[model samples]
Target: MVTNLRADAARNRERVLEVARAEVAEGNVSLQLNEIARKAGVGVGTVYRHFPTPRALLEAVVGKELATMVQLTEQASQMQDIRAAMEFLLRRTLDLQLCTSGGLAEVICAIEDADERTTHAKSEMRRLADHLLERARAAGVIRPEITGEDVRNLMAGLERAVELDPDRADVYVSVLIRGLSG
Candidate 1:
């Protein structure tokens, strides 16, 4: 969507995106465009000119991280070693849950009315789930009963738990992975 921009405008847009993403990642659910503009050394009009609404800005923040996760998951799923896939997934899940980006994932997941844009997220998760669950089960690593839905629920739970104690997420992840095995 972002094709071309003046140098100053491009810098301003990048600045807003970075600061807005960081703020939202830090649990600032109500972060506004004006605040982002102020932080970016630009005027509110400039921010609004680029991003129409707060939701749009938040969506951009979420989408940026979502793209990264999609690439990571897709890449990991293709790995020949099942343990590598599982470990990659675990690391990604832990990062998303414990890092500032965790907040954005939680917000996106919590939305009651997920539009067309969000629906694609589910499909991508299913891809990761199928890859990991099948490999884990075939290797007799984890139980066979765990489905893709189960994985999704686990992710949501992990996100919630990590939000409560970001510092303890590593411990929680270790315990959770252990429980996943047979």
Candidate 2:
């Protein structure tokens, strides 16, 4: 009976997370716990018991994507061609950001007091991104003045542009890459 109850609780938590993810993916950043509970078909107490706060829920939703970003940065750092690696990182990062409805950017770029895991992931990504930038600059593939923060802000701007005009994302990225290469 205890095992069954634990299994049921786990299922409820997963359901709440699923609904919350869907809400964020639909561009709903102001995740209301009560609404998530309603959509999850679970009680408010259950949702609170699982997530405690909206920030907690948002962190959970974006955590995987954050890890993926870090992984992409690490992968880019290992590539033989610095220019190609930088382009690959930019494209993959933008793709991931677009797919997550910009949630990853909101969390990593805007949120300052994220939970420990998220904070650590953000730091790791920044470190790897900085290393990639250094390599690109050393190889004379990109402008020497561009910093990681600049790249982050540029990507955020591109995300907004793509959101406004989805068809031109590739063109926008291509233009960005060309401009960065100088």
Candidate 3:
């Protein structure tokens, strides 16, 4: 009896987390606990039992976002054109960051010390960015002086721009692309 109860509780918690992630992704971070429970097909008490606070739920959603970014980076690595891949990643990343409340900066700040998945994702993102930058430089598509850090900083700037004024994100992204292209 105890084992079955524990298993059910675990399943319910996972369901709640999954639903919460979707909600956050859709810019619904302020969704009430009861609403989440209803969406997850669980009781309000179940959500409270799993995530005691709104911050905890947001933290979990941010973790999911991080994992998604890592996956996107890995996918970008498979693209044939380095510059195209970089552009795609930048656009996709900006879209995701803008979907959330405070953008990537806030999500990153929420995480204290990332878990293994987040850490691995960060490393993989860095490696792919470096590889893409090297290829772009070699192909003369991007300025030779540009480094991976520069690309990251540019994305950070984009995040801030999106956070401040989402309507102008496209303009900022265009400038970033133009500046990178040789």
Candidate 4:
């Protein structure tokens, strides 16, 4: 009976965390405990019992996003064609950033409070990015002199362009991808 109670409690916390992550990633950072509880289908008190405070919940959500990004970068590194993988990473990342609400701000904000796990995740992402650039260069799909920092800056610029002129995001991304190919 005690085990079942513990499991149920854990499940509630997981559900709350999931909803909090989506909400924050969607740029709704002013998350209310009541709303989170309502979304997670748990009691308001249950959320309080799990997170104690909104910051705790937000921190957990940020950690979850960082972990997710690390997994994605790892997956990208394993793709057969580094160029295609890079394109996929850019498109998918931008899509997530532009989905309903901007995720770039969320990512930037979370990075400021990055814990050890988040820091490691970011480092792993950078390592994977470097590997991808090397592979793409070796394959003659990208300029040999191009570095991971260049690609990272390009992505940041692209995100900014999209934020400034959302309707032309597709055009901007296409041009950037073509430029990278050269």
Model 4, residue 158: what's the lDDT? Answer: 78
Residue pairs with colliding backbones in model 3 are: none
After superposing candidate 2, which stretches have Cα over 4 Å from the reference? 1-5
- Per-model TM-score, in order, reads 0.71, 0.90, 0.64, 0.61
lDDT score for residue 111 of model 3: 37
What TM-score should be assigned to candidate 2? 0.90
lDDT of 3 by residue, 36-70 (tens): 99999998988887677666566566775677777
13: Cα error in model 2, Å: 1.0
Each model's Cα RMSD: 3.6, 3.0, 5.4, 5.2
| Candidates ranked by TM-score | 2, 1, 3, 4
Clashing pairs in 2: none
Q: How many backbone clashes does candidate 4 have?
A: 0
Lowest summed lDDT over 10 consecutive residues: which window, candidate 4? 100-109
| Superposed model 4: Cα runs more than 4 Å off | 1-61, 99-113
Comparison by TM-score, 1 against 2, better one:
2
Give the TM-score (vs. native) of candidate 4. Answer: 0.61
Better of 1 and 3 by TM-score: 1
Q: For candidate 1, lDDT tens digit of each residue in 46-159?
A: 889888877667666676566666677787778888777877787785676455545545543554423346457646765776876888899987788987667656877787
